[model samples]
Target chain A: MAEITLDQIIQPENMVYTRSRIMTDTVLHYCPGCGHGTVHRLLAEVIEELDLQSETIGITPVGCSVLMYNYMDIDMQEAAHGRAPALATAIKRLMSEKFVFTYQGDGDLAAIGTAETIHACNRGENITILFINNGIYGMTGGQMAPTTLPDMKASTCPYGRDVQMMGNPLKITDIVATLPGSYYVTRQSVHTPGNVRKAKKAIRKAVEYQKRNQGTCFVEIVSNCNSGWKMTPVDANQWLEENMLPFYPLGDLKVPEE
Target chain B: MGELRLMKGNEAVAEAAIRAGADGYFGYPITPQSEVMEYLMAEKPHERTGMVVLQAESELAAINMVYGGAACGKKVMTSSSSPGISLMQEGISYIAGAELPCLLVNVVRGGPGLGTIQPAQSDYFQSVKGGGHGDYRLITLAPASVQEMSDFVRLGFELAFKYRNPAMILSDGAIGQMMEKVELFDPVPRSKEILPWATTGKTPDRERNIITSLDLDPKRQEDFNLKLQKKYREIEEKEVRFEKIQCDDAEYLFVAYGTSSRVVQKAVQLARSRGIRVGLFRPITLWPFPSKEIFAMTEQVKGILSVEMSAGQMVEDIRLAVKGKIKVDYYGRMGGIIPTPDEVVEMLEKKIIGG
Candidate 1:
């Protein structure tokens, strides 16, 4: 090893990646190894790459990412619980030239906000919806969410999610894909590097569809909640691959034909 | 000069909104106020002034849409009846907490559940005393006529933006449904300047504007609340509006607002004809409540009568204003019943004058 030193590896010509300028210097409030940080990074990168840093506006939901505006260096609005889609609809309609999107969690998008979610997509609102389905309400102390897997234990479902009693785990993305207003619908995770790349691509495509004024584009990130699941980050990734992937499946559920 | 046209109160609200340079109207149909959206849709304000009119899926969605539009610093409004306004309380609270400016028109009907569709003033407490969660108050304007209905639309937006708080036109079905001569004003051109505080977009020249109501830290939330309260106090000191008719040397005062004020005006004339020496104190801004003016009247009047179309909701505010200095009595009709002027006179005579 002839001293191929740190300076050479860190040179601009050799630099492979850097933090997106679309993200502010504020430290993320999410816990260590949380998937929200990865998702936020991917969104920042996609927004920066699309050159939407100035014209893009984001609506954040009432969850852990409620303070997402602090970290994202873009104009943002915080919607009431489950009302992000409704807000996004108004924003897009009022300023059709602007790029608007909503970042929502499972409990926010699938449960309390189901009516707004389906109707926004059904009406073909020209906006993007970034849904994070972590199978539990991560912010409000790991309660059972609408997407909580059957037999998956949550704080509210300590005895495990009984399918018969709690009803089947809702696949809201699938339900939303069937709506005619939705032009593109896909589900991906950010657990692995490959998955992160795919999720970033999906985000870019959704933004592109929004720019074209196609219709509502919904991208669901089936992520993991390590603390909520009471597992280490690595164990949670393994559990997600074995469990969430089978239920949520990684692929495009709907896409418009060219 | 704009046209002086015969229009219903709700229709005037829509037209005035168009002429006032409102940028958007997102509303759901609710009885007694559905004409607001119906008239907007029919008039196509979008074609004329570039105003966006949308019939939302529900009152909940409509209010949130108003929140979004307001966050962008666009003048937006929504109209609903009692039940629908109740559904919008959560969004209204959020708007208040975020300190976004928008107009809300509540053509109140009887309530306490799926109440009647007919006009009533039962939503007084809900509108003025913070209907939604948290300590917040709407700068509530009570429009007593079709002209006031039109006038308040512009005034509501002005006061809303001035304080960066929500303002409401608290009318009733009686005003919303009744036709009257309204002198519409010339269309004010929409502002071309971007609001510095609004979340339009983040340019490289400045930091991003975030419209949010959440402050996870208790101390920060308390500070926000204190700031809101201080703003409310300033509004109370500066924005108390009322019409004091014949109150200089009056023996009895009838405190009423909206349609009840119109009817009470007739009753005051009837009482004067009967040599009862009665005056009318009509509060134009209900949230500012005209408490100082009401307190001043207490020193001059022998008694106060709070007349409304609801079951004594505003009477509490009147009593608080009087502070037990004078005998404050309430006379109201419940379940969407509109009392006649003669009936109001009779109640005044029996409750305040005779007693």
Candidate 2:
């Protein structure tokens, strides 16, 4: 073959993909192999593709992604634990022209912020909620989350989650889908390349629905917390597929009828 | 001149918020202050002035909504009574720490856990001395009449945005439920100018604006605290507002604010008729505490009588202001009872003059 140079190999036509401009140069604070980084990338890509980089407002929950405002180049507000939905509601209502969304975790959205989440969905606030459920409080040293599976080992539940004592694992996504105010409710994962593509598409749809002002759109990403789960990134993905996917099935639970 | 209308204090706050060009009002229905949202909903300020008024699920949600709206650099507010305000303290602290400007109105009611629905000044300590956590203070304005209730809404928002701090109108059920003639101001148009510092949107002209109270780094957090303290000192120096009546020649001073000030005003007149040289000092800005004026009065008065509907809460501030130069006596009714003007004067005589 003729001597090919580096510049010729980096031609625009040969370029496959690049990081979205909506994502700032600030490096993410998430742990190695954490799913939060992937979700953040998907959200940033969606915002860029929709050309909402300037008109998008994001509310970040008090969890591992609390510093998401630093990584995302968008107008952002940091909400108290579990209050992101309420904050997103007000932002969307006051500035109806802007695209508003909340990035939250299971501990934030399902545990302490349950009332706020339910009420916001019930009111049909025109906002998108991106929920990452890893079945444990990742930032707070892996305590038992509301979505923590039965027999799952957590720092608080050292003997594994006892169904009788700790009660059953909660499926907040399904509960929220039953609410009439929720126009679109879906559950997806980013464990595999195929699944990541699907989750990205779901995020784009959620944002599109938000722009149309068609009530609340909730996307629950069944992610994995490798460090919290005490597993290698690959093992964590396998564990999530085995334990979490069975409980939180991978598909749209509710969608507005065409 | 704007129109003059007879309205309740709560109704006046709602109307004044509309005229002040508030972008949104998020509130929950609490006793005494429920009329604030009721009036806003009835008038549909959303249709008239494009004000987004929503009744939140609870006071907690309402305050967070105010935080969200304020983060967008819009004029937002909420009104609640004592119990409701207690639920809002966490949100208030976060708002203060985030340094977002927003208005809050507390229509005071008896409390220590749903104590009563009647008016009480027991929350004086809670309002001015930082009801929430952290080293923070709210620019508290104690409005004594329906007119002041209307006027303070405009003033509260003005001061809130000016200092980028939360401003509170500390009224009670007495003022909130009572009605009087209020000269309404003409509606001020909402500013269309973009807020460069607000989290409106991350436009190309500026870096992204992030509204947050969290600073994990201890050094940065300490810096933020020092900055807030500096702002508070500036406010205390420039915003200490109070009214003095017959103070230059008075021998005794009655220190009060809000409804107690109204009662003390009557007592001042009654004491003067009885040949007692008594005057009233009404603090308009409670957080700034009007310490300078109260301290100056020590030069002219023999003693100061702190009258309130609470169990001598504001008396602490009066004593601090006096600096032991003169005796500051507290006279008041506990629970929700309102002392009569004669009773206040009698207590002053028994507690200070006779002593």
Candidate 3:
């Protein structure tokens, strides 16, 4: 085999990217094998494929992905913890021309902002919501999230998340789907390449529906947090698939039949 | 010119807000001010002009919703009574900290805590003194009549965007619920020239913008506060608004605003009839305090008698303007009780004339 040169790898002509990177090329500080990188890539791919980078506005919630704006090339509004839905509601209402989406964690969506989320969805706002369900608060160092699995270990749940004491993991997508105005609701994972591709499709569809002015599209991406889970990235993915999926089943809960 | 219609003060505000190109209105229903929301709901400005109108769960949610729309660079607003406006202070402070331009209307009511729903001016201090926490101030306008109530909607939006700060229309329950004939300007499509700097989301040509009030560094917060104070000072110099009645040569001038100003108007007429040489100093802009005009009048007048439906609120500002050069006395009736023009004239005659 011929020896490879740095010039060949860095050449502009050889670039295989047909889609523009709406997400910045900054080196993400996520731990190795962290599912955030995969999730971010999928979202960026959807934005690129849909060509929605220019018209899109992302409302970032207070969580690990709070600074997701730094990486997303589109305009971003940082919202108070759990208030992403409220922010998105106002933004979409006022600037109806722009495509608005909210990126929230389980804790932000189900805990403090439950009322805001429920009402926004019920109102059938024309906006997309990307919810990352990791089952723990990664930003504040692994506290128990509203979506934390029963008997799962977290800093706040040192004795493991006991359902009897802490209540069951909230299934927000299903609950949201029950609202008449919620046109599309789905849960997907990104552990493997096939799953990652499916998640990108779901996210792209959600954005497309929002552009069409469909009411309240929600896409939940089940992800892994290695640091929060106290596991390696590879191990975290496996633990999530085996333990998390059973409790939080993935698939389309609501969709407009075409 | 739009078609002229007879309307209440609250109804006019709601109609004018839609005409002024406000994109969103988030409000809660309260006594004496419920007509504002009721008018919006009936007219359905959302369907006609693409405006969004929501009766929020509470005053707190309504204001926060305004905060959200303003962050997106949209012209948004909310109206509430004293108790409700008090609930909105935190969000108001956040809006100010973010330097967002939006309209807030307070239909004044007697209150320390839900004191009474009847018309009162007790919210004077709260509106002009920066009701929320933090070192910031809102541009406040006091409309004494139904006409001014309608007029301030456009003026509040203009000033809010000009100063990149929240602007308030402080009316009382009587004005808010009072009905009168109003002539409003024709509907104007939202002018892009007004707010070119509003956050329109991520465009390929510009960097991402973040609107927030969180400054962890104390020094940075101090610097921000100083900048805000400087802006307020400039507003005092340029944007102060007031009305003068018979102050060219007068011994006693009654200083008041909002609902109290209307009573003072009648009292001035009564004093003039009695040959007491009483004039009225009504501040249209309460935050800037109309100090310049009050000072100008003080050069000729003997003293100022502040009349309000509160214990004593505008009196403090009158004192600051007069600066002990002229005696300043206050007359007020609290907790939903309004002092009539006769009562104010009597007080002036007793305190400044003989008593």
Candidate 4:
């Protein structure tokens, strides 16, 4: 077979190509059929549509998406484990004109960083938070997370999450919505094309609120960890609807009164 | 350029910070130093000079807020007492390790536990030596009076930004609570000085900036530490400062800092009245310790008295400087009890003039 030239191999039309300066060109290390790919794509498309690449600053937390900055083409700051909110607080306050956002996982946000996230939201800082709740610690070999549903089995919870021993799944959106500074709080799932579209809207609204300097806006994307859950992408989405959605029902928790 | 105003040391610090062109103040209220936060709140520097004043929930969050502001290349400050300052040591170490410039003030009260709300100089080692878990040192300045307490804001900020290091103004309950007359000076605006290293953002004309302290490699951290040590050496040589009173022909030298210095000054006067040749060496920069100055006095004075608010803290430094060249005596009062001038004079008579 003849070796294909670089130009011939490139097809911009068939690929997802847009103006998001936040995502880098580095090859993603995420497993095939992982929901992170879908979520990252949706966010990148929204960022491209909004034309916020230059003014956007992404914060990467410690988790499966720890290297999320590597795929984004924009300026990125890596936070200490579970400290994205604190770092974002600094970045946004210092550069108020810049659009700042944090991409965190359930373990990083709901568990180790509970206080940081709560206080940051309570303080009413102006920034967007994109929380990925996968119900388990993916990068750290699938330990249970604060968002792990009851009866969900993981490396740490082989007998399934016992509410008696472990705590109940944290309802972050509901808790954060109670804070007066929260201009927008919504939870979305990315198991279906329709749900992915809805997740995109929630993310877009969050970014928009940040743009308007309204206040803290958070979007929780209930994603699937295919490898950690020990299922194919299709099966994971189906499992999500049957198991996770009932517990973590997705919808807007708060919005402008108007 | 004005008349002296009588004010509490905490209020003077707040006023001086505002005049020092500080754009941000993030602090929590703790006794003996609550006035610093209250003054900033009531005065509302944000309304006049565009300063950002925030009352953080805890000293932990407040210091982190200062860290964030400093990371932005803005002049920020935080004030706390001994217990609160203890909680800030981790963030301070991070700031120093990252080489971010900011100001911190410690209005000390008694402490080992939640010791007391009264005056104490027990944090001498904590301030001069590294309090946090690291091999780093912060530039520590000890103010002996309310006037110097206010004046320290200017010097602390100047040294902080100049060296890209954290500068600390270590005072105590007395200095923070007592009233004194001070002639304040306006701070030179930061815009007047050019700081190319500040992390504003990536400009079209320059390279992208990253403010971080993550060094995964051992060799690289060693190099960074070496550079820090060299910078510290330069600061030791150039910034070490102290006050010397009547030491030209003295038989005894009283070495002290902060509130202890005032006690020594009073004792020196009393000694002179009794026809005794006693002098005082007061260190303004606690970390630098005025070693050369104190070392020079070894030839003039028969013995050095280390008078402090704690149980022989600064005496270690006095002994180190004297290096057995002269006899060293210690006088102290612990647990928030300040040694009176008479107590120091008596120690001098028993330890030096009589011995």
Best by DockQ: 1
Sort by DockQ, best first: what order?
Answer: 1, 2, 3, 4
Report the candidate with higher DockQ, 1 versus 2. Answer: 1
Better of 3 and 4 by lDDT: 3
| Superior by lDDT: candidate 2 or candidate 4 | 2
Clashing pairs in 1: none
DockQ of 2: 0.86
Q: What is the C-alpha lDDT of each candidate?
A: 0.93, 0.93, 0.85, 0.83
Considering summed lDDT, which 10 consecutive residues are worst modelled in model 4 chain B?
Answer: B190-199
Off by over 4 Å in 1: A1-3
Tens-digit lDDT track of model 3 for A1-258: 999998878788888764347768777766778777777777888888777776777877777777777787877777766777777878888778888888888888888778778888888989998888999998889999999998999999999999888888888888999998898999999988889889988988898888777699999989999999999988999999999899889899999888
Q: Candidates' TM-scores?
A: 0.98, 0.98, 0.88, 0.88
True-vs-predicted CA distance for residue B349, candidate 1, Å: 1.8
Tens digit per residue, CA lDDT, model 3, B106-219: 998888887888989888778889899988889999998888888999999999988889999999998988888888988888655424445576565667676766665799
Stretches of candidate 3 exceeding 4 Å from the true structure = A1-20, A25-38, A138-144, A149-169, A191-194, A224-239, B1-4, B46-48, B192-196, B214-225, B272-275, B349-355
TM-score of chain B taken alone, every candidate: 0.98, 0.99, 0.96, 0.97
